[model samples]
Target: MHTYLGTFIGVLMVLTLQRVKIGPWGGTGGHAWDEGGHGASAGGYTGVRRMSIGSSWCVSSMLFEYDDNGKRVKGTLQGERDNGIPEEELDFHGEVLTHMCGYHDNHLIRWLQFRSNRNRTFGPYGNLGEDKAGWTRFEVSMEHSGSIVGFCGRSGNFTDAIGVYVAVWNPERFYDSMRRQGVRVYRASPLRMDLRQIEEEKKKEEVERGRLQKEIKEGRERLLKLRLKLGVDVLQQYQEIVQQLERGREGKRQTIEELQVEHEQLERERGRLRKELDLKRLRESRLEVELNHMQTWWSKITHL
Candidate 1:
C-alpha cells in the first residue's frame, strides 16, 4: 500500500513539473536564453550565438527527459564562445550536440553524448561569432537492447541546470531515424576511469586542502595578535588619563582642606579685634569725665 502511495506521489510531481514552459518537444523550455535570446520556431535553431557572461566561452547542456527507472532519454548539447582565451590556433567557437540511447540493466539506460562544432580557423583560438546561422556537424554511437521509450531533456545550467537529455526507444526505430537525419548509430564502449586511483587522488587533494586551511588559520591568528596589541596600547592610554584625573582630584581636595584651616584662623583673629575695640572705648569715656570735673573746681576757686 505504501509503495502504491509513493508511486502516486511521484507521478503527481512529474505532472506538476511538466507544466513549466519548455521546448515544443517538451525538453528544455529553450536554449541559450539570455533576456532577448528566448524564443522558438518549428525548425532548427538559428540566430547569432552569444557566450555566457564573463566566461571566455559559453557552454551549457541540460537533461530534459528520464525514464521511470531514472535513465536519461535525450542527448547533450554544449556551446563554447570564444573570447581569445584558448590559444589562437584552434577553432574555439562552435557548438556540439550528441545523442545516444539504449539500455544496460533492467533499470539503467545507457547513452552516448557527442557534439558538432563550427567556427573560424585561427590556428588554435578561433574568434567567436555572434551568429548561430552557421553550418555545423556532429557524430555519435551507442549500443544496447531493451524496451525503452521517449526522448526529452530538462532545462538547467552548470550548477542549476540538468546535465543532458536522451531518448531511449527501440534501437531499430531510433537507428532508422538517425540515418534519415544523417546521424550514424552504431555499437561502441563508453569511456570510463579507474575508481581506486581516483580515490587515492582525492585523498591527496584533501590533505593539501587541510594544509591550506591551517595556513589561513595561522594568518588569521597573527592578524588577531596585531589587533590585540593595538587594543592594549589604547587601554594603556585610557589608564593614564584615569591616573591624571585621580591626581587632579587629590590636589583639589588638599586645596579645599587648606582653605578650611585658613577660614578658622581668620574667625579667631576677628574675635580678638572686637575685644580690643571695646576696651579702648571704655578708657576714652573715663578720661573725658575726669577732665570735665577738674575744670569746674578750678573756676570756683578763682571766683573765691
Candidate 2:
C-alpha cells in the first residue's frame, strides 16, 4: 500500500514540474537592503550569457556577461567593490535566465537562487543568517513570451534593490534599450572574480580531481586484494578444524565398537557355565537311585 502511494506522489510531482511552459511567469522578484545607490541595469539583446556572483553570509556583488547577437557585452558591476570575496559563476551554455527566488533580511539579501530557461537551478548563495527574524522570501518569474533581457537594481555595499528586465527572445532595439537604462559592459566587480579567472580556477580543480580519482581507485584495489587474502586464510583455518573433528569422531567410534564386542563375548560365556551346572546335578540324582536298588536286592538274598 505504501509503495502504491509513493508511486502516485512521484507522478504528481513530475506533472507539477512539467506544467511550466517555454516562457517565464514574469514575477522576477529579488531583494534590496536600502535605496541610497543609483538604480542600475544589466542585460543585453540575446539575454544573459553568464553571471559572476560574490557573496558571504549576504550577497556582496554581481556582474552580468551578456550576448548581443553573436558579440559579447559586459555589464557593469552591481554591488560592493572590495576584493578577496568568494564568487560563484553561472554559465548558461546557451540557456537564458527565466526565474529567481531569494531570502533576505531587512538590510541585505541573505541568499539568492536562479532557474534557467531549461529548468536548471543554481545557487542559494550567502546564508540564512543566524537571526531568522526580519527575513522575507522573494520569488519571481517571467509572465509571458519573453526571456530576461537584463537586471536593474540599486547598488552599493551590497545589491540594494534588484529586478529583472524581460523582453521577447531577440528584440533588435535591445541595444537602444540598454543605452537608455540597462547593463551594457561585462566589466568585473573588483570584489567579484572575472570569468577568465574563474575558468582557469575550474581547469585546475578538474586536474586535481583527476589525480584524486586515480588515487582512490588504487586504494580500493589494494583493499580488495587484502580482504580476499584474509578470507582465504580464514577458510583454510576452519577447514583444518573440521578435519580434526572428523578424525576424533572416527577414533571414538572405533573404541566404542571394540568395547561392545568384548561385552557380548563375556555374556555368552556366563550362559554356557550355567547350563553345564544344571546337567551335572541331574546325573547325580540318577546315580543315587540305582545304588538304593542294588542294596535292597542283596538284603533279600541273605534272608533266604
Candidate 3:
C-alpha cells in the first residue's frame, strides 16, 4: 500500500509540473484615467489593475486572471491616447515606472502599469502576490484615437530575462501616432536563452541578418538602375538642347550671309546712280555755255 501511495504522489508531482506555466509572474495596481476620479478596482478578481488620472491622454485598462491555485496564468494591458502625447513623454512614463517599480525585469508588472498617471505606482506583490505562481503569459495593446496601432506578447522563463516568445506591432505608434502610426511591426522568435535555445537563436539571427543584407543589396541595385536610367535621360535631354542651339546658330549664320549679299547689291546700285548724276551735271553745264555764246553772236549780227 505504501509503495502504491508513493507512486501516486510521484505521478501527481509530474502532473503539477506539467500544468504549471513557467515565466515572470507579477501584477500592477493603479487607477483608471477615465473613471471619473475613481481608483482602479480588480472587480473582486485578484490581478493587476491599471488606471489613469488628470487627462484622457493617459487612459488605460488592464486585466489579470489566475487559476484556482492562485497562480497568475494570463494578463492583458491596453493603453489609449487621443490627445497626442509626445514620444518623450511616453518614454518618461516608462522610465518612471521602471525607476519606481522595476518593471523592466518583469514586463508583466510594466504591462499592469501600462499608461497610468505619472503619480501612480505598482509592484509585483501588491498586484499579484495573491497568486501562488506568477504570470506565464502577457499581452499588451495600445491605441491612439480609437485606432489599435500597437500590440505585444511575451511568454517563457525569466531566468535569462528573455521570454520564450515575444512579439511587437507598430512600436513607433507611441512616438507620433499621427505620422508614424502602424508603420513598423515585427516579431521575435521565442527565446529561452538556454544554451541550446541561444544557439538556435543565434542561427536564426544569422539567417535573418543575411536575408536583410540581401534585401539591402537588392534595394541598392534597384536604386542604381533607376539612377542610371535617370542619367541617361538627362544626357539625352542635354544632347537635344545642344543640337537645338547648334541649329539656331546655323540659322543665324545663314541669315547674316544673306544680309551681307543684300548689302553688297545695294552698295553697287548706289555707285551706279552716283555716276549717272555726275554725267547729267556735266551735260547741263555744256548746254549753259552754248546758250550764252549764241546770245552774244545774235547781238553782234544785229549791231552790224
> Judged by lDDT, which candidate is best?
2
Superposed by TM-score, candidate 1 places the C-alpha of residue 181 at a distance from the truth, in angstroms, of 39
Against the hidden reference, what TM-scores do the models get? 0.32, 0.39, 0.38
Give per-residue CA lDDT, model 1, range 207-242, as digits (tens). 999999999999999999999998999999999999
Q: Lowest summed-lDDT stretch of 10 residues in model 2?
A: 17-26
TM-score of 1: 0.32
lDDT of 3 by residue, 1-304 (tens): 4345323332332222111011223323222111110111211112112222112211122223222122323333333332432222221112111111112323333223333223333422223333435344333222321111112223222111211111112235432542343222222212212333457568999999999999999999999999999999999999999999999999999999999999999999999999998999989999999989999999999999
- lDDT per residue for candidate 2 within 59-101, as digits (tens), equals 7787776654445667777676557643444443345566677
Candidate 2 residue runs with Cα over 4 Å from true position: 1-44, 81-93, 169-304
Better of 2 and 3 by lDDT: 2
Output the worst ten-in-a-row residue range by lDDT, candidate 3: 35-44
